[model samples]
Target: MNQAPRQRMTAQARRQQLLTVAWQLVRQEGSAALTLGRVAEEAGVSKPVVYEHFTTRQGLLAALYKDFDSRQNALIDAAMAAAGDRLQDKAAVVASSYVNCVLTQGREIPDVLSSLDSTPELAAVKRQYQLDFIEKFRSWFAPFVAPSDIPLATMWGMLGAADAISNAVVAGDISQQEGMQELSALIITTIARCG
Candidate 1:
């Protein structure tokens, strides 16, 4: 009997496939399972393929982190755009959208954090993205608070609190609604206090 020929995927398609497989490993099996070999085996591709796309484990994590942040930032931008002129309304929408994203993404944030935390290059990348996010928050809150009043440290603190609350909701320690409500309140108050 003659076997059918397999369809070949393009390089970009294969890269995306590998990333998807890696993401699944991180989400379902934990970030510890996302070795190049495991990703290769699970993706049904050779180890060389993963190496070709991502020069190192750190490279793969960097790509994943960039993609994750890009997507999350896009969501936040959309939420803020649709939130109208009121800062409180914008804060509530932003908080809800952010926490809801964390709750719905199913371990993506933790997996990204775990996979990228140890690598200095990727860690720097993460930090830069965070700084950019904080800058955007600073711009939004500047009218309410002076540039000196809303320091980067304070913004980082608020973000840390939001993430902690979001993690609690994701882990079932708190309901999603409660988490959103609490986060919205926190964000609003934090903005108000920044003044």
Candidate 2:
């Protein structure tokens, strides 16, 4: 039997390929099984190549998270752009986009997120992403709740609810439709109270 020769990829393309394989490894074997050497082997690349892109396991984990965050942000932004100005429409988009993003990523994200909290540095990275997300929520809903700024605590509370409900949806504890309906109502109610 003859093996096909591997095709050369650009540096950026190779990094993307490695990230894709890393996510696959996490999805198939959980985040605990993710490692540079394992990703290299799975991608049919040498360990050096993986190391070059992600200097350490922590670096790789961070990249994986950032990749997920980037996708989530894009999805939300696009949905928001298409959403009507009504509070109900915006809230629905937020709930749907968030739940759909997590569902699309499957169960691997929670594991990756747990791994990200294992170290201080990774925790900071995750925290920053959370803070950024909260800011986004503030900006999106602030217009509806204008004349009164949404309290930071309120924003945090909303984020907490979103995470919990989305996790429940992903875990099959609640159906996606149920999660979205609950989340949308919570958002509208929260903003209404603030207003």
Candidate 3:
């Protein structure tokens, strides 16, 4: 579907294209350059058509945020596939994969995260994505604990670290490997001692 004709694209497919274009542009130029006119010109469609697909800039950015989240989720699922019995090991995989995805996507995740908390609209858009990811990560770390022993704040902390690591890496203040190692250590130790 990623390769399908722009004209023949299904609603889902067209949205996917919109997401694809948005990611490329945002990744290349950061979120400031994410404009409907720019996306329309790049996708070879009219501005109104772009608006039809994504009613507002935030709507489009929100959709791209979902796309990035899905990609992160898929990477986690793939990492856990061959993981050893240790839930920490699975988490190490998730950290590495998540870090890699965020680093490679440039500034999309960082931009979204930075914009989200301060801006009500973006915060509302990202709210569910944050929750879903936290639940998934919490479950990944669950086997490290007796189900009754796990603390809720641990989930929140780990997800916050994941976002921080992504932002640091995207800001180029840390290397990708550094981000992965720190995340792996932080999450594993947090689960080990607290869970």
Candidates 2 and 3 compared by lDDT, better number: 2
In angstroms, the error of model 3 at 109 is: 2.3
Model 2 local distance difference test score:
0.95
Residue range 57-93, candidate 2, lDDT tens digits: 9999999999999999999999999999999999999
Model 1 over residues 92-190: C-alpha lDDT tens digits?
Answer: 887888888787777777777765678788788888888888888777767777645687778998788878888899888999889888888887788
lDDT of 1: 0.82
List of clashing residue pairs for candidate 1:
none
**Candidate 3 lowest-lDDT run of ten:** 1-10
Per-prediction TM-score, please? Answer: 0.89, 0.95, 0.86
lDDT of each: 0.82, 0.95, 0.79
**Model 2 TM-score, all chains together:** 0.95
In model 3, the Cα lDDT at residue 54 comes to 81
**Candidate 1 to truth, TM:** 0.89
* lDDT-sorted candidate list, best first: 2, 1, 3
Q: Write the per-residue lDDT of candidate 3 for residues 129-154, one digit (tens) a residue.
A: 87877777766667777665557687
